[model samples]
Target: MYLYGASGHGKVIAEIAEELNISITGFIDGNADIESILDYRVIANNADGLEGKAVISIGSNKIRKLIALRDNQFDYVKLISKKANVSKRAIVEEGTVVMMGATVNSDVQIGKHCIINTNASVDHDCMIEDYVHISPNVGLAGNVEVGEGTHIGIGACVIQGIKIGKWCTIGAGSVIIKDIPDYAVVVGNPGKVIKYNEIQKLSQ
Candidate 1:
């Protein structure tokens, strides 16, 4: 399989794949100067277009990951770390990576290009949408639904059945007890929205 992006996150993804005994083709980062970071060679801009599987392997939820999939028809690829414990009944879609020590319980449905970082625990029946990033040591209770492009910061916790909306950012160590709206920036204990995501508007 081919891995996209040669940044620090890409290196981690590469390492995880190696540990899992998956065949890695190479990386495709926009920055072409990345020669041999993590002892992996970067192929270049437009990824080699090889006739094989590929993973986004990115960690930046701030920049929407769907952008990388535009017009590309590579089949979805799901990767679970060898050290992670994922229930066989759980449905993890392509372009998703479950990092080391992460535990995904039964009935969990994780969407494309989502990152479940190291030591994160996702309870049973949770729904995580596309491009969502669950940071290191995060925890989500049962039945929680994380919307597209949402970012759960490191050490954050979300109560059961809470609906975190699209592109929302939950700050580190925040405890989310209520539903969060799309594009909201939330932080602190009992997490509350601090600001709206103005970056999308600025880009438009």
Candidate 2:
């Protein structure tokens, strides 16, 4: 396996791969300055001629999506840390990474390229769409539905059955008790829509 994006995120994924005993061929990055990470050779801007599986180790949802869509040669692989407690009934799609100490309960469906970050708790029957990032220590109650490209920040909590819309950002340390709309930027306890992300709307 190879990791794209030779940065901090890639380093973490590399460690997860190590725990799983998966052989990492190298690291690939667009940045020419990054020569190596953790002793693995960094191939700069040359994804051509590469075969086998790879993971986009980028933290940004948009960048992950962009790379996945643009790079067609390599098959994406899901990396679930050996230390993570993922239920057998949970469905985690390709290119997704479940970090160490994360808990994914039964009947959860996590989409492609999503990040279930370290120590995050995803309760039963949750639906997490593509490119979503459930940051470290975030908690999602049972049956919560998080949309595509949405980012639930570190230590955020979402109540049961709440539907967070696409491209929304739930701020770090916030508590979400209500449903959120698309492109909304939510914060504070009980999570209010402080503002709409007009830039996201324009991009989409």
Candidate 3:
């Protein structure tokens, strides 16, 4: 599998690779012209050899897309770190990464292309929809439902049995104590709706 991103997030993902004993070919980044990520060289510019099995390490949604547009050849591979605790009852779909120190409890369903970042915990019965990103140190209590394309911020915490809507953005360090509406931007202790995301259609 190939890692797509050579800088910060890629570094973290590489550590995860080490823990899992998986072989990573190299990285794909726009910033650095440098050959190697620690020890591996950045070869295959278009990433033709590793399509559909490479792990994308792009942090933000925008950057992820940018890199994907640059070289959409590599299919992002999913990585579940060895240190992470994933229950047998949990279901994580393809192209999703469960990073190091994270815990996914029983009966949790994670959708496609989602990123469950480092140290995050998703308790039992949580349904995380597609393209959602649960950042580092985020915690979701039991039966929490996160909608599609929602990006939970770093260090955020969601209470039990809450339903966060689609395309919602939870602010960093915020505590979500209520149900969020679709396309809402939520923040602070109670996680109020600060703004609503305008829905845009992608080109076919």
Candidate 4:
């Protein structure tokens, strides 16, 4: 296995790789300044030697998607921690990672390049779209639907059957009860939208 980054996100994935006992060949980083990560050597760019399966250890949804799209020569590896409790019925797509202590209940569908962070709980039948990040300690009740590229902040709670739209951000410690619209930045105890179309605009 190889990692496509060597920064903080890469460090977390390196730990996951170690936990899984997967031997990392090296990290393919563009930055020449980065020498090594936790004793693993950093190769300057993928052309140096990287091939076959690798994971893009980037935290940004936009950059991760871009890298996935741009790099078709190498296969993307999905890194699911052994410590995570993912039901056999759950469907986790390629390039996604279910971190340690995370719980993915029955029939949950996690899309490509998504991050089900440490200690997050995704309840039964939840649909997490592509590039979404369910941050550490986040909770999603049964049948909740998260749109593509949306971010559920750490410690946030999504009530049962709530639908969160694409590119939206649910602030940390917020309680989501109502459906959020696209590109909305929601926060507070009932998850009110503090901003709208801002995320989309920034992306554009």
Best-fitting candidate, scored by TM-score: 2
Query: TM-scores across all candidates?
Result: 0.92, 0.97, 0.86, 0.93
Segments in model 4 whose C-alpha atoms lie over 4 Å from true places = 45-49, 197-204
Question: What is the model-wide C-alpha lDDT for candidate 3?
Answer: 0.82
Worst lDDT run of 10 residues, candidate 1, spans: 62-71
* Residue-wise C-alpha lDDT for candidate 3, range 114-195, written one tens digit per residue: 8899899999999998778999999999999999778999999999999999878899999999899988999899778988
- Tell me the lDDT of candidate 4: 0.89
Q: Can you tell me which runs of candidate 3 are displaced by over 4 Å?
A: 48-52, 62-76, 201-204
Clashes per candidate, residues 3 or more apart or on different chains: 2, 0, 3, 0
Poorly placed runs, candidate 1 (over 4 Å): 62-64, 199-204
Candidate 4's residue-wise lDDT over 21-136, tens digit each? Answer: 98998888889998898999998865434478888888888777877888867888789999999999999998898999999999999999999999999999999999999999
Measured on C-alpha atoms, candidate 1 has an lDDT of 0.84
In model 4, pairs of residues that clash are none
* Deviation of model 4 at 123, angstroms: 0.4
What is the per-residue lDDT of model 1 for residues 115-176, given as tens digits with 9 covering 90 to 100? 99999999999999988999999999999999988889999999999999988889999999
Q: In model 4, how large is the Cα lDDT of residue 132?
A: 94
lDDT (Cα, tens digit) per residue for candidate 2, span 121-195: 999999999999999999999999999999999999999999999989999999999999998999999789999
Error of 2 at 8 (Å): 0.8
Q: What is residue 97's positional error in candidate 4, in angstroms?
A: 0.8
Candidate 3, residue 146: Cα displacement in angstroms equals 0.9
